[model samples]
Target: MDLFWRYGFATLPVLVFVSFYRMGDVLTLTLSHPLWNARGYSLEAISMADGAVALFASMAGVAIGGWIAARWRMGWALVIGALASAIGNWVFAWLWDTPLADGSLYLAAGIDQFGHGLAGAVFVVYLSMLVNPRYPAAQYAFLSGFAFLLPRLVAGASGTIQKVIGYDGFFVMSGALSLAAVILLPVVLRARSRPSDQPEPAA
Candidate 1:
């Protein structure tokens, strides 16, 4: 269990990098496209607002998700998080083709941010529950390394992918990947239900 947890955490940077890269590329492409671009807004302004909103929303979601994880089942949280992530990605993708006024873009940005924020919060809580306090030093080191390295590696090709596949395709692919995380939830829940030397609470 510990090994599995460590490996997962260690790969997190890669996952995040891929996710963010896809997100940024899709956003840029969508907002800059002549037919899909938001009315009365510059690309830079849209990017800045979207980025800022995503950051704040993610922060808040993490705090809330952490609290929820303490009392809920980790498997359930993971499933919900996966679904939320997929939904968020879908919403962002939808924005690519949505024709709207300036204020409508703001609303769309808010919805996108909210979905991502909730997903982040639930995901953090799920991951945290997997850690064992006894081997904190080694585990933490692995997590830290992954946190810094994976994103850099995975995000590198994001721009190229966007150029090749376009915004809609990129977003659909990303959403599918995020949704795939849910497949592991049942396995995780079964593992948790087994009797252990030190039985821990769910989540």
Candidate 2:
């Protein structure tokens, strides 16, 4: 508690963003249902696109995310990662309306997985950045656990949300929700500086 406040990460906006960060990402679930039942895609095709292609795409994203975390401001990385994920969700919605061209399905799956990897990598780094240097293990455990706690619990409501909105609307909302993280970025960045960069008081 003392450390959280001293580090400037205990505020409502930061807490809210951390808790809900996974909401938009997870909404991209149920991929096989639409692909297999509605689109008539084969298991092999699904396996190829989601399993193999997605693995490579996600790896690429993770690599890029790592580079960005190393070089760039993490706030910008958050923006990039979140937008990629949100756009990935919207891509699925758009493709569902249009007849999927050959390879389009694979492309959509790849984008989603890539965004997942990017955002996930960036988020992990961000959490680590917030951990108190003196109490790395314990603080990180609390933060990491709290981060996913709400998102996982609220995940059950997704099916209900989908039932009401249908796929396209659901996906669009998912995209917008992810953008919420982007919107919160300024607040988070302003509230908390990196531990190493912790501002010193006037002499």
Question: Whose TM-score is greatest here?
Answer: 2
Error of 2 at 144 (Å): 2.2
Predicted candidate 2 versus true structure: per-residue lDDT over 10-48, tens digit per residue: 466777888767667776764424533466666777788
State which candidate has the highest lDDT: 2
Q: How close is candidate 2 to the true structure, as a TM-score?
A: 0.85
Per-candidate TM equals 0.64, 0.85
Clash list (residue pairs), candidate 2:
none
lDDT of 1 by residue, 1-203 (tens): 55454445434443443244224323333333332342346776577656775567657656655665666676666555556555655665666766655555555555555556665666545445444666666765664455335334544666676678876676666666666656544444444322234556578
> Candidate 2 — which residues are off by over 4 angstroms?
8-10, 30-36, 100-102, 193-203
Residue 148's C-alpha lDDT in candidate 1?
Answer: 37
